[model samples]
Target: MNFPIIHTNFWDAVIAIPIIMIITQLTKLIYHTPSKFVPTIALFFGLFISIFISHRHDLLAGVLMGWFYGYAAIGNYAALKTAIKSYRNANK
Candidate 1:
């Protein structure tokens, strides 16, 4: 199997991931989906964006980068929750 070329750049971390995360949250809000499905939805959306928008001709690269996009959002949310909890505890 041939591997597709993928470049990891600043946009992936700073722009794409955050955008994907926001989209995921918006989707959750619009659909009224359960909180547990957020990560899964984000992952599917990532794959869709990568395959259809970013790397149309490069399926492998799209899948790989899509995984990153999804996971980054998940990690971001987790970190935010942790920080909020820490702040609340410190203040109280």
Candidate 2:
């Protein structure tokens, strides 16, 4: 099996963070009807972005992009859960 080499570049990290955030937010908004879909959509979008946009012909960019997206997704998910809980509590 052939393995790709990894090289880390500062600009790749800069571009990846916001892309992940945007994808995560879009997934959350569009799939509001079924909250479970948000994370799945985010994961797929994250993989897609990392594979396409962050492609540096190296694995490092891919790894970083995945890490950024994963962390951001978790944060977004937590925020959504908290908001839903608060809304439910307020209505009670």
- Could you give candidate 1's per-residue lDDT for residues 19-88 as a string of tens digits? 8889988988899999998989888878887777776788888889888878888889889989999999
Q: What is the C-alpha RMSD of each candidate to the true structure, in Å?
A: 1.6, 4.8
Off-target runs (Cα >4 Å) in candidate 1 are 1-3
List model 2 lDDT by residue over 13-45, tens digit each: 566555666767766677563776656666666
| TM-score of predicted structure 1 | 0.86
Q: Pick the candidate with the highest TM-score.
A: 1
Model 2 TM-score, 2 decimals: 0.52
lDDT of 1 at 81: 89
The true-versus-predicted C-alpha distance at residue 58 of model 2, in Å, is: 4.6
